[model samples]
Target: MAIIHYFAPMMKMRIFGLVFLGMAAACYNPPRNCNDFKEGEFRFTTVVGENEQTTTFIRRKSIEIDYYQEKADTSSIRWINDCEYVVKKINPKTPAEEKSIHMKILSTTDSSYTFEYGLVGSSKKSRGTAFKVN
Candidate 1:
C-alpha cells in the first residue's frame, strides 16, 4: 500500500505530460502553399562528391525543363495533386533515367519548398529544398 502511494503521483504526472504532448501535436500544422510552386522557375543545389552542383528548372502545367552541368533535360510532369507529382524524362539516355520519380511537397515558406522524392516504385526516399527564382 505504501509503494502504491509513493508511485501514484509519479504515474499521474506521466499521464499529464503525455496528454499535454498529444494536445500540442494535434494543434500543430506546418505551412504548405503547394499551389504557389506549381508553375515557376526554381533552383536546387546539392552536394555531389566533393563539389556543390546546382540545377535550375522551369515548371509549367504539364512539363518541366531542367538545366544542369551545361545540359538541359526535359521531363513530363503528371501532377497527382497540388502537392504531389511524378516526373518522367522525355528522352531518357539510360535505363535509370527512364524510371519516373515521385515527388511530394512536404512544406513551404515564402520562396522555397521542401520536398521528398524517390523512384516511383522504390521505398527509399530523399529530401531536398528548392528556391523559387521567379
Candidate 2:
C-alpha cells in the first residue's frame, strides 16, 4: 500500500515531464538548408478546409504571397528558414478567415517537398500539406 502511494506520484511526474519536453521541441524553429528547397518563383494550388484557392509565391528575403480570386490579394511572410516561415495578412479588409499562417516544409527529396501549414492563432486552427512543382 505504501509502495503504491510512493511510486505512483513519481511515475506520474516523470511522464508529465516527458510530455512537456515533446511539446517544446515541436515549437522550436531554426534555420534550414537553402539548397534543399526549391528557391525560386513558384505557383501552386492550395486547398484549405473546403475552399479551393491558388497561390503564387515569390521568394526573396521573405515570401511575397498573392491570392487568385476576382483580384490578387497580396501578403508578405517572413521566413525563419528555408522550410519554416511566419505569415500574417498584409492588409486585411474584413478580418478574413485566418490572420496568420505557420508554414513548414515536411520532407524534401529532389524536386518536390511535402509541406504542413497551420494558422498562427490557436483559436482558429488549420493543418494541411502540399507538394511543390517546378
Candidate 3:
C-alpha cells in the first residue's frame, strides 16, 4: 500500500506530461503552400569565396531562365510535385553543367521560400532561401 501511494504521484505527473505534449503537437502546423512559389521572379544570394553572388530567375510553367554573372541561362523544369522539381540546363557549356539538379521547397513565407538542392541522384544537399522579386 505504501509503494502504491509513493508511485501514484509519479504516475500522475507522467500522464500530465504526456497529455501536455500531445496537445502541443496537435496545435502546431507548418506552412507549406508551395504552389505560391511555382511561378515567380526571385533572387537568391550566396557567398562564393568571399564574394557575394546573386542569381535572379524567372520561372514559368515548364521552364526557368536564370541571370547570373552577366549571363542568362535557360533550364527546363520537370516538377515532381508542387514542392519538388528537377532542373537541367538547356545549353550546358561544360560536363559539370550537364548534370541535372534536384530541388525541394522546404518551407515558405509570404514572399520567400527556403529550399534544399543537390545534384540529381546524389545524397548531398544544400539549403538556401530565395526572395520573390515580383
Candidate 4:
C-alpha cells in the first residue's frame, strides 16, 4: 500500500511535466513582415534533380515577372490578404500551368520570408524561403 501511494504521486508528476512541456512548445511563434515582402525583387533557391537551382522574380502591385533557366514568364497576383495571395501564369502554355497557385507567407526575417504554396484547392503543399534581392 505504501509503495502504491509513492508511485501514484510520481506518475502524476511525470504526467504534469509532459503537459507543461507541451504547452511551452505550443507557445513558440515565428515572425512575419508581410508588407515588406509585398513588392520587391526576390530570389528563391530550390533543389531540382539533385542540383540547386535559383529563380529570380520581380513583384509589383498586381504582377510578377520571373526569370528562370533563361526563360521569362509573367504571372498575375491576386492578394487575398497581407500575407496570402494567388498567382496564375499570365500566358500558360499547358493546361497544368493554368492552375492558380495559392501562396501564404508562414514566417519572415529581416530580408526574407518563408512561404508555403500549392495549386489552389489542392492538398499537397510545397514550402520555400525567398530572399529580397533589391
Candidate 5:
C-alpha cells in the first residue's frame, strides 16, 4: 500500500516531465534572416560520390556566377520571394543542364542559410547549408 503511494507520485512526475519536454520541442523555431542571404558571395559544400566538393558563387539580384573546379558557370535567378528563387543556367550546354532549379531558404543565421533545392517540377529534393563570404 505504501509502495503504491510512492510509485504513483513518481509516475506522475515522470509524465509531467515528458509533457514539458514535448511542449518545448513543439515551440522551437529556427532563426531566419532572409535579406542577409539574398545577394552575396557564398560557398556551398556537398558530398558527391564519396568526395566532398565546395562551390563558390557571387550573386546579384538577378544573376549568379558559380566557380567550381576550374570552371565558371553563370545562371539567371528569378525570385519567388525574399527567401525563394528559381535558377536557370544562362548558357546551358545540354538538355539536362537547362532545367531550372528551385531553391528555398529553410532557415538562416547571421552568416549562413540552410536551403532545399531541386529541379523545377521534380519531387526529389536536396539540402545544403551555404555560408556568406562577403
Candidate 6:
C-alpha cells in the first residue's frame, strides 16, 4: 500500500507534464497556407488615432496599390509579379518619388487574411490580419 501511494504522485505528475507539452506544441504550429491569399483585390481602411486612411490593391500580374485620405489626392503604386514594383504619389506634390515596397501574402481564410509588408526605405516590418468588407 505504501509503494502504491508513492507512485500515485509520480503518475499524476507525468500526466500533467504531458498535457502541458501538448499545448505548447500546438501553440508553435504554423499557419494553414498562403495560396488562398493570392490572386485577389483587397481594400482596407483603418482609423489611426482619429485619422482614417484607406488602401486598395489588386494582387495580379499588373498589381496596383492606391492610398487615399481626406483632403489628399490619391497616391498609387504599380507592381509586376516578379517581386518588383514602383511607387508614386499621385498628388501634385514633388512629382511623386519612385520607390519600392515589399509585400508577401501569409495565410488566408474565407473572410479574413494575413500578410507581411513593408514600405520602401523603412526598416519597420508590419503584419496584420484583415476582414473582408460586406
Candidates ranked, most accurate by lDDT first: 1, 4, 3, 5, 2, 6
lDDT of 3 by residue, 1-134 (tens): 99999999999999999999999999886687899999999999999899999999999999999999999999999999999999999999999999999999988999999999999999999999999999
Whichever of 1 and 6 has more lDDT, that candidate is 1
State the displacement of the C-alpha of residue 55, model 2, in Å, after optimal TM-score superposition. Answer: 2.9
Residue pair clashes in candidate 6? none
Q: Candidate 5 lDDT, tens digit per residue, 1-134? A: 99999899999999999999999999997887788987899999999999999999999999999999979999999999888999999999999999999999999988899999999999999999999998
Residues 1-134, model 1: lDDT tens digits: 99999999999999999999999999897899999999999999999899999999999999999999999999999999889999999999999999999999999999999999999999999999999999
Per-residue alpha-carbon lDDT of model 6 for 1-134, expressed as tens digits?
Answer: 99999999999999999999999998884454444444456677667789876766554444343435434334354554433344455444553343445665556678667666776768886776655543
lDDT of 2 by residue, 52-89 (tens): 87765655455455546646666677787767887776
Per-candidate clashes come to 0, 0, 0, 0, 0, 0
Model 1: residues with Cα > 4 Å off, grouped in runs: 1-14
TM-score of every model versus the real structure: 0.86, 0.54, 0.86, 0.85, 0.83, 0.54
> Clashes in model 5: which pairs?
none
Clashes of 2: 0
After superposition, which runs of candidate 5 have C-alpha atoms over 4 Å from their true positions? 1-17
Better of 1 and 3 by lDDT: 1
RMSD to the true structure for each prediction, in A, is 2.6, 7.3, 2.7, 2.1, 2.2, 5.4
Worst 10 residues of 2 by lDDT: 124-133
User: Where is model 3 more than 4 Å wrong at Cα?
Assistant: 1-7, 15-29
Over the full model, what C-alpha lDDT does candidate 5 score relative to the true structure? 0.94
Q: Tens-digit lDDT track for model 4 on 61-83?
A: 99999999999999999999999
- Superposed Cα RMSD, model 3: 2.7
lDDT comparing candidate 4 with the true structure: 0.97
